[model samples]
Target: MTKTEKTKQFIIEKSSVHFNKIGYLGTSLRDITNLTGLTKGSIYGNFENKEEVAKAAYKYNAKRIGNKIISALNQSPSGAINKLMAIVDFYKNNWSVIIETGGCPLLNAATESDDAFPKLNIEVRKSFIGFTKIFEDIIKNGIEERIFKHDLNIKEYASTMVMLIEGGVLLSKTMADKEYLNISLKRIENLIHNEMKL
Candidate 1:
């Protein structure tokens, strides 16, 4: 990468966790400068504004989370059902990293940006849609493989699972009880298993 590109990535990587932890409104330019040890001119040279950097940092955080999920899913040996369960397992194992960093990026952006920031809101929406599509694709594959029932509505089921998982993350963070998240995930597993048997 070019010098400017490398600097932009450096800023994004350094500030991503802080942005995710404290959020866009709560984070300041000084915070970014301090974290990256980059001068104001340098930082601004790479990013047009604080908002741009915040958006990029949020995307970086989301990409990291997505990568972890994809890695776990790819590593699972069983079929789609086991792959789905592996996703739940990943979240449970990474709960501390997730909760400590802030919350699920989707939930954080949805609650923080949906009403105020149009650009960030759109980004969050697209992330949600993309995540749901992953589940949808998995369900469709399972159905084609004769694992999931033929009558199942892949889109609806996938959407419901995504909503429940995101909601469960929020609840777990709010309640400070990981069990809430586990229970929600168990319900999803049961739903999938029952549908598969039909």
Candidate 2:
């Protein structure tokens, strides 16, 4: 990467932790400066404002989480059911890492941006909808392959699946208990075996 590109990425990478942990509004330019050991002018030299950096940080954090799931999915068998189960297992196995990274980036961004930051909220909404679309595609493929029920409501099921996963993450993070997420995954598994599967 070029020097400017590297520096921009450096700022985004360093600021992501604080943005994910503290939040968009709560995090400040000073925090970014402290995290990157760069002066305000240097930071501005890379980003237009704190808002721009905040948006980039959110994308970086979301991509980090997305890439993990993509990796897990890639390793699983090439079947819709297997892929769905892989997602559940990914959360089951990586809850600690997820928690350590300041919880789900989607959850954090949505919670903080929903009412306050309209510009950031747009990105958060797109990221969230993108996830639901992933689940929907999986379900659609399952039906086409005769692996899932033919009459299933793909949209509702996909949305619910994503909701349950995020709900569990939120509860688990708030309650400091992994079982909340485990229970949620258990529900998904049960639905897969009993409700969705052919």
Candidate 3:
């Protein structure tokens, strides 16, 4: 990467956690400057505005978690059901890492960007939709392999899994209670085993 590209990425890496932790409205230009040790002028020289920085930061945060999930999914054994279990264990095992870093980036961005940050709102929504499709694809493949029930409502269940997982993240973060997320995830795992499994 060019010096300019590397500098922009450096700023994104440094400020991404802060943005996800506090949020768009909560984060200030000073925060970015302070976190990255870059002057306001230098930061602005790289980006058009605070909104642009925020959009890029959110992408960085989301991709970090996505990479973790993808890695876990790829390493799982052949069965589709095992693939789904790998996703569950991925979240469960990474809870500490995620919570320490300021919780799920998509949830954090979506909640904070609801009205004030329109561009970010679109990005956050797309992230959730993409995540939901991962579950849908896994379940569909499981059914094709006769490892999961054929009548599963792919759309509803996939959407619910994403929604519930995000909700658990919020509760866990706010309450500082891992049990909140643990309970919700248990429910999801139960559905996968008892209801979906063949």
Best by lDDT: 2
Off by over 4 Å in 1: none
- In angstroms, the error of model 1 at 68 is 0.7
Give the candidates in order of lDDT, highest first.
2, 3, 1
User: TM-scores for all candidates?
Assistant: 0.96, 0.98, 0.97
The Cα local distance difference test for each model comes to 0.88, 0.94, 0.90
Off by over 4 Å in 2: none
Candidate 3 vs. true structure, TM-score = 0.97
Ranking by TM-score: 2, 3, 1
lDDT digits (tens) for residues 62-130 of candidate 1:
899999999999899867788888888898799988998888988888888977778888889989998
Q: Who is ahead in TM-score, 1 or 2?
A: 2
lDDT of 3 by residue, 110-195 (tens): 88889888999999988888899899999899889998888989998888888778888889889988888888888888888888
| Candidate achieving higher TM-score, 1 or 3 | 3
| Error in Å for residue 77 of model 2 | 0.8
Model 2 TM-score (2 dp)? 0.98
Task: Give the number of the best model, judged by TM-score.
Answer: 2
- For model 1 the local lDDT of residue 163 reads 84
